[model samples]
Structures are given as C-alpha cells and as structure tokens.
Target: MSAAKIGDINLYEILGVEFEAEQADIRKAYRKKALECHPDKNPDNPKAAELFHELSRALEILTDISARSAYDKVLKAKKAAEVRTKQLDSKRQKLKADLEQREKDASYIQSYSTVPKTDEEVLQEQIERLRREGSKLLEEEQRLMREQLVRTMLEHQYAQAKTSCDSSAHRIKLKWKAEKDKSNGGYSYEDLTIFLKKYGEITALVMSKKMGSALVEFKTLEAAEMALTYEKGRLQNPLHLEWVSVPGVKVANETRGSILDYEDLVMRKLRQAEERQRLIAQMLAEDEAEG
Candidate 1:
C-alpha cells in the first residue's frame, strides 16, 4: 500500500487502534468507528461522511496481509519521526515561553530601580535644554551683573561729588550800598529773598545795615556773581553790588550790628572802592593820551 507518505498523520491513531493490534481487532475497531461516524447515523455533522470514508480506506489497507506488511514499516518510520518532531516542537515552545518570562522579569526589575545619572549625562541634558531655550538665561545673568556693577559705581561717584561740592567755595558774601535811598525802606529782606530764589539755591539769608550798606551771603558763587553783575536787576534804588567776606555772625541784624565787625567791613570796602576808582582813572588817562 504505497498510498501516503510515512510522515503524514498516523492512520492507526485515526482508527483508534494500537500499532500491535491483530486483524480481528482492527476490523472490530473499524466497524465501531464507521458506525459512529456514518452519514445516516450523524446526519447533522458534515465531516462525518468524510471521516467514514477515510476510516473505511484505513480499514481496507490494514486488514489485507500484503498491504499491512508494507504499511507497517512505513508506519514505524512515521511514528519515530512524529515522536522526534513532537519533542523538538515542545522544546522550542518551552524556550519561547522562557524567553518571554525573562523579558517580563527584567522589565519588572527596571521599573522599580532608578538609573543613577553620570556627570556627562547631566551636562548633555543641560546642553539639549539650552539648545531648545537659547542663551537667554546666560544673557539675563550678565545683564543683572552689569546693572549691579553700574549701580555700585554710580553710588560711589555720587558720594564723592557730594563731598567735593560741600567742601568747595559755594558760599560768597556780598555787600551792596544804596546809591539813592529815602531811608524809609530801601531794600526789604522779603523782596530780596523772593527775587534771589528765581535765580539760584539759597540756604541762608542775612542783612546788615551798620556798615552803611547791606551785607548778604549766597549759597553759591554763581548766584553772588549774578546779583552783582546783572544789568537790569537791583535790590532797590541803584544798589552797588560788591564782593565781600563771610562774617562770623551768620544772621546779621540790621538794627544791631556789632561795632568791631561793622567798622572793619566799612574800612575794607572804602579802601577797595578807592583803589578801584584810582585804577579806572589811570586807565582812562592812558586811553586819552593814546587817542
């Protein structure tokens, strides 16, 4: 019976008979299976008819003496191959299952354990973030540092400037005599104070009348020069503005001037005026001679 290959599905297993079964045994098994799988008996099962045909074919092949002998050698080889295939298949499936289990175990261990960061990795992460964000952080830090340095330098320079201004010649005393006055009220302190405020910063005010003039002190040299040389400005009745020295008493009283200080101031001013007039007269004489 050169019907099928040796390694195909076993016919004995299909017929429910052992490999060592007798012909009578094969016949009995075949009859039982044919009845169970018959078209008339199992009308609802479509495969029943096909199974009946295959079983009948198997029975015919096995019951004949010559066919059975030929099939027995092939069947033995088929059984051995089947056994080897089943062993190899089982081992392969088991190895696949073990590999899957190992992967699952590794994943579980890694999920709970944290990877410690290396310095290079941390630096690399920072580099990546900086690439995305640009150099704004570095620029902001530099800007802040520059601002702080500027502020510190400005504060120091401001302090030095303030000290120099304080120590320098900001104060200048001014003496002025009225050219023509009714003596009723030639220069009132109130009017002078208000007028001076428009031009410069004034910290203190003093008026002295004992020296036949008013002695005034300004907080700034520019203010004293302005009051002395202004073309249209005057205290009252043709005021003669002159530079003088700062006196000991700050707020000089017009009605009660000290005797020694008043006399000295008067003499000094009179000498200065006479010397100035002499120089002017000499200059005028020289000019006329040249002409």
Candidate 2:
C-alpha cells in the first residue's frame, strides 16, 4: 500500500467500512478484511501481504482516540488531493483523445484528397516500370517451375527409398459425387481393407461421414500417384480419387482433365504475356524517340 497505484484505494474503501463507523464496527470490519487479504489465506495473491499490512495500519490508527483524530485530518486532505488528481487525469485524457482524432482526420485528408502532379517523363517512366514488374512476375513463375521440378525429383527419391509409408500424407481422401447406400454401413475394418485393394495396394482404408469421404493410405507413394491420375472413375464405383493434401476439392467432377488441356493453358498465358511485353517495348521506344 506504500507503493504507487496501491494506497490510492482509500483505507475505508479497502476495509469496506463507513467513515463514521464506531471502533467496535471498525474492528469487526478489519478482522473480516484482514482474513480475506491475509497472506496465509491467499497464497496465490502476491499483493495479499501488502494489503494485510495496510489493513493493520488502518485498524491501529482508527482504534486509538488521538491517532484516529490525527489520521482523519490527513485522510480528509488526501481525499481532496485524490479527487483533484482524478479530475485532471480525466481532462488530460480527453484533450489527448481529441488531439489524436484531429491528427487522424488530417492524415486521411492528406492521403486521399491530395494527388501529386507528374510530368510526361514520369508518365513514360511509370509505363516502363510496368514492363519490369511484368518481367519479374514471369521470372517468378519460371523460378516456381524449377522449384516444382526439383521437389518432384526429391519426393520421388524419398518415396522409393522409404519402406514405411509417409506418415504425413500417406492417405488419399476421396469423396463420392453421388448418394451412397447407408444399408451397408455395418462395414468392418477388414471390409474396408478389401474394398481399397481394387484401387492398387493400400496400407489402410477408413470411411468417415465427418470427412464426407473415404481415406485410403497407399502401400507405396507410386500407388497414391496412380490413384490421383484416375480423376474419373475407371471402375464401377464412380468415386474419383482426390488427395487429402490438395487444399480444395469440395466435389470432384466425373470428367478428367487431360495433360494437353494443361499445356494449352500454359501456352495461352505465355502468349498473352509476350504480347503485352511487345506492346510495352513499342511504346517505350516511341517515348524515347520523342524525348
């Protein structure tokens, strides 16, 4: 209670007793407050010892006639000072909040309302800058392709070397596009094992309603790879395989996408990017000649 932000809680407030309380009433309140704030009673509370000491001091001053009168005069002066301190804090906080609001308003106006003017040279520079940005994107895409290739090689090496299945993503999660028969819900673990054997060899197969699909762990990574290729149903089940590792596939289509389609997409994007670069170069050359 001698420390800052501690003794600010008035002695009367801490004891929760009225200012005009008699010695007997004050004594009773002190005992209750002391018991509640006692070091022995509150082992978890670090502030219990300080509060107990403060309670003892309050009781000592209030119990004695001379000490009580002296303490009352000091308490009255402290209360007046505390009130003034609180009023000033509140006023200062209000002024600080208003200043912050004004700064925020000024910042918003400066950011959105005011636009800087640029010359023809700046415009040409901006146009030229876009070509570098576009080239960077294309370069990033190439880097990604190289990384993907290296990753594929490393994954292939790891899969072939390891006898035990990949603990992380050994399982292939696939959802049925159509309604399944619930009558055959009484399937055992052994039955699931037998069912998954149709799609290459698997370590385990688990069906879950919560997952909304069947999770089948391939015996080898090659098996999982083969299963992924079967986007459309090869057999009667009509349930196309999708890897759990794939982020999104709420519902996989019955139709499969060919490698040719993927290649065509890459070609289209490359052509578009090249066309853009050609236009940019032409514009930059004309700007340089004019300048």
Candidate 3:
C-alpha cells in the first residue's frame, strides 16, 4: 500500500487479527484467510487474486516490528481525527436544536401578542360563559330526573305485576321459622304433608330441608289462597307465603294458569321509557298553563 493510503488501510482488519495479536497469531490468521481467497482455490472469482494479495501485504506489515509500529501511529491518528469530527458534528446539532427552540418561542409569543379587550367586553364574555354553563347544568338535572323517574316507575310496575300473577296462580311456597328444638333438625316433607293436605287436594309438595320451607302446588287456586290465611300450619313456627317467580314472566296478564309466558323484557323497558317521557311532557304542559 502507498504511504498516502496508510490512513485508509487497517492491516489488522485485513489480516482478521486484533491490533495487540502476537506475531504467531497474526501469521496463523493470515494463513487461514489466504487459503479462503487463494487464486487457485477460487479460480472462478475475479476478486480472489486481489483479496489474496491484500492479505499477504497486510500480514507483511503487521508481522514486521518497525513497520507495525509505524502503522499503529497512523491508526491512532485516524481514530483521533474521527473522534474530533464526531465531537464537532455533535456540537453543530446541539446549536441547531437551540436555534430552532428559540425560533418556536419567538413565534408563540408573537401569535399571542394582540390588542387587549376592554373591561366591558371581558365582562360580556364572562356572562356568556356563565349562561352556557347554566344551560348545561339545567340539561344535566333534567336528564337525571328523567332517569330516576323511569327507575321508580319500573319498580312499581314490577311489584304490581308480581302481585297480580301470584294472586292468580294455584301454587304457594312458604318459609317457616327454624325449629328451636335440637332434637328435630328442621321441617321435613312428611311432617307438613297432613296439615297442607287439609286446605285442599295437594298436587305436589316440595320440601326444602336446608331452608325449612315447603312449596305446595294445589289442584285449585282457591286452595292455595286458603293456605296463606293459616299463616302457621299446625306447626308452632310462623309461616310466610312467597309467590313463585317463574323466569321470563314480566306481567300477570300474559300468564296462563301456573305456566307464564310474558312479553319481551326489551319491549317493557322501551314502554317504561316512553311512559316516563309522557309524564314529563304532561308536567311541563301543566307548568306552562299555570304560568
């Protein structure tokens, strides 16, 4: 290699050895690399001859004591120059970033710098803002009231429908107080059979051993109603009658005997919403008339 190209060439890299490698290690690396790119071994490759010559030259420079020392000086100078160039580039980038930030700050200040509003104009703006806020608050209040009214109406309707359905059904389930006597665990199916049968001909009797309750299905609706009148059936414990809750039963009118098939719950929800809107409109109309 020429003296001018000394900075461009790295002998250690060409020989595939570290700069601090021993002479024996450098020769070993060079031999291994030279075989890979030997002209005879890679006859079809045009770059093989050039690579093989470069490897030979690199090995010659790296192995010689005086030549290796001179090349090391050139490599150090090249690295120093690269570090200085990087430092200068970094400083230039930092200066450019600072200038851009200053320009942005100046632009922002210029955009906001305008003629100040009069006292009356500022007061009018405040009034307009307050008016908008007041209107929003009033709307929010009305929305909340409508939601609350719908919820209350739905609860009332559910209670009324359940009552009507239970009154019309021929089955009644009652919960009895837990027995105080430790000897008797709780009410069994056999214990309450005779007492429940007295009201009417019992179709079915289900005893909940755990809860101490019984569900009696009677042949006639009147029989079920009569059972509720007893309150406590022969047993010392007081009985509380609860209507059976069948799934999908939204209203009493839709039920047939014990088997109930009600309208879609979605329809009921929509109807309740419509009722709430009607009530609100009626109230508004009355208020306007009074005004």
lDDT, each prediction = 0.53, 0.53, 0.58
Tens-digit lDDT track for model 3 on 192-282? 7777778887766765433545566666566776777774754556567865542234244443322112323323544644553454455
Question: How much is 120 displaced in model 1, in angstroms?
Answer: 69
Pairs with backbone N, CA or C atoms under 3 Å apart (clashes), candidate 2: none
- In candidate 2, position 124 carries an lDDT of 36
Q: List the residue pairs that clash in candidate 1.
A: none
Better of 1 and 3 by lDDT: 3
Per-residue lDDT over 1-291 for candidate 2, one digit per residue giving the tens place of the 0 to 100 score: 221222334667767789898877877787666655667557899998888767765665456555455455556666775676577777786886688699767766776555452232233343344334443432443355445544444444343333332322445665554334553333445645655666667765655543224566676566677667754442544555776554222111201334443343334434543543454455445535643
Candidate 3 — what's its lDDT?
A: 0.58
Residue runs of model 1 more than 4 Å from their true location after superposition: 5-7, 83-291
Q: After superposition, how far is residue 147 of candidate 1 from its true place, in Å?
A: 99
**lDDT tens readout by residue for model 1, 84-141:** 6577777786886688699768866776678554333343444344445554433443
- Which ten contiguous residues of candidate 3 have the minimum total lDDT? 257-266
